[model samples]
Target: MPTAPALSILDRSRTRSSGSDADAVRATVRRAQRVEALGVDGFWVAEHHGVPGVVGSAPTVLLAAVAAATTRLRVGTAGVMLPNHRPFVVAEQVATLAALHPGRVEVGVGRSPGFTAPVRRALGAPASADADERLAELLDWLRGRGPVTLRPQVPAPPVWLLATGEGLRTAARLGLPAVVGGRLLRDVEPLRRYRREHPGGRVGLLIDVVVADDAEAARRELLPQAVALARARSRGEFGPLPTPGEAAAAVGSAGLTGRERADVERYLADAVAGTPGQVRQRLQEVLDRTGADELLVASTPYDEDVEAANDARLAALVPELVGGLRTAG
Candidate 1:
């Protein structure tokens, strides 16, 4: 069996409908602590604007908290959506984070247009057309290649571009790592192209992970995450994650309607859920296929107890699985 790559994490700070958003934030911090102690290389939080389902709106702020709470972890945004905020603000914030955390900070940038028209309008992001320009501007600010000086003059951290569409080419041109997602699992000519263009450049794999008693059991534990995504697609609303009971009531085997059923299937298809042995096998396949240099686990469990104790479970499960693989090798 192939050994797992250096592991990392992506915490979406998904809030439960019945709990406070602060609960999610604090939970993410705790997860970071566990990730750090478990020897994960990085812990990345996301930046979503006006999305109720995700409470990690201010990634820099949350990263600062994560950094203060842990000493060794590389803290960063899975990405900051560049178009949603001013480039200057991003440059300053990242620089400040780097200054505070030193070599332990990472800078991942994304140019995703907001999820909805209202969100885009609220952020004043023009259109899909603006993404490339915004991405370029953000890069210029970070790389200091442009005329503007990054205020305070702290060294910027390693930049990772969230691989999406043409952004792959940009990351290659700049010699930055690209975080490859499962959505792009079908076609990774981009990652291949990236390595060919920038020899030996690293690419990070971001995948959904769930570890429970068994494959079916793990999938069920991850259903809330799948269901939350389905709800977003079916309703155009990204509200808090529904409780397992609530999700099962709405989209269980017999409850789903046309779009809901389709959405649920699609979301479930992207996840990797199983016992340690099963997860290890599937992740080995992913690693062989993508040849990704790093692995970033994105967990979305349904049970409130599981959600609250994710860090402990993941801390125990990941090491056991990875170690078992390595020992076998």
Candidate 2:
């Protein structure tokens, strides 16, 4: 068993209220560079299509840019949605990236289709598409079992399932590692079952983890994302991130309905936000309960400076959370 869990970041390239989509994409690249300099283990980008709140639609393309901008930083998609793409094409793209970066590229794939009816129509993603079968086919191509061999012919990069619930079973059945989040983080039975079923398979947790001088300040940084989730759930549209002050104002001015208020609270409740010591304790509890092999921080604050600082703070705190290595220094 590994002595320490790997720590990484997943940036969704979220567009802030003050910036354009282009700015958001550029900011992702910059964030990748910043985290790499802080000794972060890896950087993953997300895929979203026609979402007003996110700009990371083309994950592989953005990953290519991120890879080019940083040396020694493992880059990947968090991931590419299989239902919206052809398995062969997805295999080809990841193969090319692996060829270019050698040991520095990883590919994670998901079953999600478009986020809404309009986006689904735009992508022509059929609602009935079989994601499990699609995932099997994608694996075949990546493993060189397909009719046509992928060009540049590099070794297949590591593949991780971006999953929850049934997806966990699928990953375990296929003997692949999984990155899971949401309710799965809170409920350990499924995660424990996955570990038992696939003893060699690795599990990663995706979470909103922030560190600040005080617990309140840390949670305040997560308010914007919680508000975005609330809006998405209640109004069917997730707008760009608002400043913490703006989010608090919305809560105060009856901008959010009772249901939306409850949604925001629920979202915040699921996040791990606090001072460094508090965050360390909460994360350790989570890691122990879930037996995760990796921790993927997925927090994005409205302030870029705060985001960067939090990344640095998390990096500084990671050494203390590693099991036997906590007291090494």
Candidate 3:
């Protein structure tokens, strides 16, 4: 088996129509606690704005709660969208958090716009002519290499770019880590380009996986999340994740559209789902293919109990696969 890389998490803190957002936030807090107990290297909170289906609108505040709950896990965003907030304000927030937590803090940034046009208008930030230029501006502000003094004056924590394409090269030039998102499942060319540009630059992979007692149970747990993503991608509708029963009923319903069925199946087929041993083997396969140094496991099922089981099984995979596992960072 390929070596198990540093394992971490990227929690979306998905909310259900059946529950309040507060329930999701509490679940997120408990999740970081579990990550610490499981000895995972880091816990990353995602940032989504004006999306009813996702409750992690403010990563800084959510990360603060997470950092306070766990002493061992490196807490950070998966990331904060640069276009949504002023660079200096973000720098201050991150610096303050890092000052409070010291070495336990990290920063990750991205250029993703909000889910819809109204959201963009609400944030009052237009798309940058060049995201890289904006990213450069943020880095300069955070690094304080310029004449102006950045307040708090705390040591800047490690900053990672959630990237692909030229963004990988940009991160390389900046001498920082690149988090390859789940969109490009196990793609290595970006990582290769990054290393070729800046040898020894850190690379992390984020992908979805579900480990259950059996294949049927695994698919059952993965079904709703897969359906939700497909709906977002194919229909541009951010629908609440359906219950597993709802998903199954949709599959066989007279109301099921051809396009929807295909989209749902595509995501379902793409997810890694099986027994614990099988999940371990497949994840190692991804590691072997990508040569990534770390893995940010991204699985946000609507049900907390399902999520807890999935996380436990995931944390156990590497120890059994590699004979023994050490704490990750």
lDDT of each: 0.75, 0.87, 0.78
Model 1 — which ten-residue stretch has the worst lDDT?
Answer: 320-329
Best to worst by lDDT, what's the order?
A: 2, 3, 1
Q: Clashing residue pairs in candidate 2, if any?
A: none
For candidate 2, lDDT tens digit of each residue in 65-165?
99999999989889988987888889989999998899999999998774777877787677678998899999999888889987868888899999888
List candidate 3 stretches off by more than 4 Å: 1-3, 127-129, 320-329
Candidate 3 weakest lDDT stretch, 10 residues = 320-329
> Candidate 3's residue-wise lDDT over 161-261, tens digit each?
99877778788888988888655554556666777787767777777789999989888887787777666776676666688888777777853577877
- Residue 280, candidate 2: Cα error in Å is 0.5
Query: Model 1: how far is 119 from its true place, Å?
Result: 2.6
Clashing residue pairs, candidate 3? 41-328
Q: Give the number of the best model, judged by lDDT.
A: 2
Best by TM-score: 2
